[model samples]
Target: MSTKTGADAEMDAGGTETMTVREAIRSALREEMEDDEDVFVMGEDVGEFGGVFEVTAGLMDDFGEERIRDTPISEAGFVGAGVGAAATGSRPVVEVMFSDFLGVASEQIINQMAKMRYMFGGKTEMPVTVRTTEGGGMGAASQHSGTIHTWFAHFPGLKAVAPGTPAAAKGLLKSAIRSDDPVFFFEDKMIYEQEGEVPVGEDFTVPIGSAHVEREGEDVTVVATQRLVGESLSTAEALDGEVSVEVIDARSLYPLDTETIVESLEKTGRLVVADESPISYGVHAEIAARAVEEAFFSLDAPIERVGVPDTHVPFSPTLEEEVLPGEEDIQAAIRRIY
Candidate 1:
């Protein structure tokens, strides 16, 4: 609940320290690695090589090669191993490098990691955490960039968390690590270097199913996820006098904080769902569906959805930027609803 709109509050931040999203995630992993003997990190280059994004840079040196295992390039092999390890009592945090590569291991994710607990008649717990990077910045092309979280969110058994700020990245990652069910933690590769205040203690964690109102206002409600959270906040700031926007960060996609959104819709009467996933049959559609279902009478305007068009992330920088929703896109969506 450390949610606020204007510049992240540094006042009275007792145990909070400033760090980048990447560093915050690494710190969470380190604390979990130290606190739990069963918690181990495994993935390509996570050991001596220190991960493609270097999120696991210094972990191998401190925890040794055994705990920070470097697996082969096979996503299915290591991912399936992590699923088996989680069911057998070990808490495995497996990195898939890029979320696009998750398709190579979809069978393990969709079939085993997601369904093990229910399929085993509630007798088993799949405490597996799959960490992957998403988004279209840095010119990574079609293969490396994608917002495929909606697929996992649509699945019944898996939990999904995507954080937009350093504090959120730390808090949500810790909670995901501790959860008994399988969790997919998606990190926007573009925001790795973005810095913010993060709680210093290992015990600090944001509740999994709660949403944070980053900016409180009386006009419209803009519910966004991942990178779009920050973008929508910026948009709100730019339109300060004309449009009073209330920004809500939908941190957890699955087990979404429907109550928070419904309440916001009641207050503002206008909602714009901003997700990086494609526009058709995606996260935006779900959020809109929720608003219509729960608070249809309170709405003063139609619900708007800001997202990429139905297509793969383009290789051209210009094309990618064009398709990806930006602050302008969010503002336009709000104006449409206004």
Candidate 2:
């Protein structure tokens, strides 16, 4: 595991505790539940089943059925319940088994959960965190494998974060739980097994709305989110002496760290935004737009975007592989500009 750096080192002096993304998320839940009695987790198969992805594995044994609630197979009902609970002064971490199912509960999330505080003139507290797994690497097919995080990121009065690493998974979740605003935490199902060094301290939290620079470079800047962050980093490494590629992990979706991205673009003068969402009106467009508006003068070449074309995730492994964005796609985007 890599050593601690930046804000991670400051919050965690104990140092060097490595874990998978799943473990980091579970640990964050355990710590948050223990720290605050009001905090609890509720979702389908989250109790005895330990979650479909097993991210909530063993949480039931520790927190019991009350805290680690198992809801009926109804996303809309449970999500609405979570909103009600949050409004009544409870910090509920609701998990929608798969992010694709989030559409079933879109009304509750986009309406009640998102608009409550504003509708109530900021008097009501909506400290709720919705955790859902996203991405298509598992071959979960069109319905289950869709990456629709951009919807919430664009929605008003909602905070969204998509973590790219284990530390980020843990730290960002902790911050999301504590946040007074409703935060949607998107976890890429493919990265659950990926391991990295995460902070051991309970107080550790990567601030929401912040981005982390995974690698520094000069030739080009590649801004990525979730799974693409690691893929872009690998692409950067492969180019080594050939291309100095700067990789930035955009952990927060809504509060896109344009400052960090613009700074990198000012130096590199070229950009490639890589995300799993569709290219049209997706995360890549938002990031690229921000760069153009903020750092248009620094551009040496047109910004490139790497993402899936406007299409559903194919059920066939071959077709899925063909459409999904990856290291090859990232490398190709970089090559076009260079």
Candidate 3:
């Protein structure tokens, strides 16, 4: 619904369309599969069930069971198979139903998939894209709902991205699939249904390691990820005349894009990092550390970090809501330094 802005303008041109995050992701999978016979999707419920989040909806019908494979309820097995497939010259797009379960396959992901190419002296190719849903707000509880992208982002030899909009979801997914490196594509589950404009071509892709400035302002700069990107943008829009808050969608977490944040800080001199990850030793902490190292002299006040407290997501909706940072949290964080 964001109209006339860069996000909207990108779609207004020919070969662009509007869709939901989930749809965009599915579309990206379709395009990649069509473009490459080596590209295939494997995950639980990905084939017949069309994915737990329906991100792979209709993919099986289009690509058949061979291309859209459904594995057992074993995360370690399927994820390991994906790593093997990618190493053997096939581009495997694996989906772990919930990112929280990624811990089950950490050995294969961290030790094998992430380390293969580097460990093999550049002999191996890891064009594997692991698509996993993250974030809380659906009350999926600690077992199902969790923001664990920081684990991959912090780990070396692996690239990580968390897109906040439909266009980003589509473009980034395609980029991850085409990448010759292992890319962890973390999609915020809460935003899957969120609508936005996306490019309509198979060749289009949002470059990895770049940040998208959703809104520009000369005041405080808010570097946000996942759900917080849209929330912070809405908060900024609501405070149009009262306070000018610049919002940046941190699409790529690993390649933190410190240049964009530093440039914005050079102008605004104030920063608040909004992440769905925990407040400690996570995405927000890394970004804040980069800001301090790069733009410490430009900072006008203490950098604020808005995120979930260091605790498991509670099963109770009220308790979950209490811990998850929201628009109010972003607004409050922005106001603290002003």
Candidate 3, which ten residues in sequence have the lowest lDDT sum?
A: 1-10
Q: Order of all candidates by TM-score, from best down to worst?
A: 2, 3, 1
Model 2, 63-146: lDDT tens digits are: 898999999999999999999999998999999988899999989988899999999999998999999988997777999999
| lDDT comparison, 1 vs 2, better candidate | 2
What are the per-residue Cα lDDT tens digits for candidate 3 across 1-338? 12243334456575678799999999989999999999999999999899888889898889899999999999999999999999999999999999989999999999999899999999999999999998889988898878999999988889999999888888888889999999999999889889876877676788788787788999999998888988998999888998888898889998778888898999999999999988889998899999999999999999999999999899999999999999999899888898
As a whole number from 0 to 100, the lDDT of residue 269 in candidate 2 is 98
**True-structure Cα RMSD, model 3:** 2.8
Best by TM-score: 2
Best by lDDT: 2
Instruction: Give the lDDT of residue 120 in candidate 2.
Output: 94
User: What is each predicted model's overall lDDT from 0 to 1?
Assistant: 0.89, 0.91, 0.89
- Per residue, candidate 1 scores C-alpha lDDT tens digits across 1-338 of 34532123422456578899999999999999899989999999998988998999999899998899999999999999999999999999999999999999999988888988998899999999999999887777889989999988889999898888888888888889999999999999988998887767767777777787888988999999989999999999999999999999898888888999998988999999999989999989988998999999999998898999999999998999999998999999988877
Candidate 2 lDDT at 75 equals 96
lDDT of 3 at 53: 85
**Total backbone collisions, model 1:** 2
Model 2 pairs in collision: none
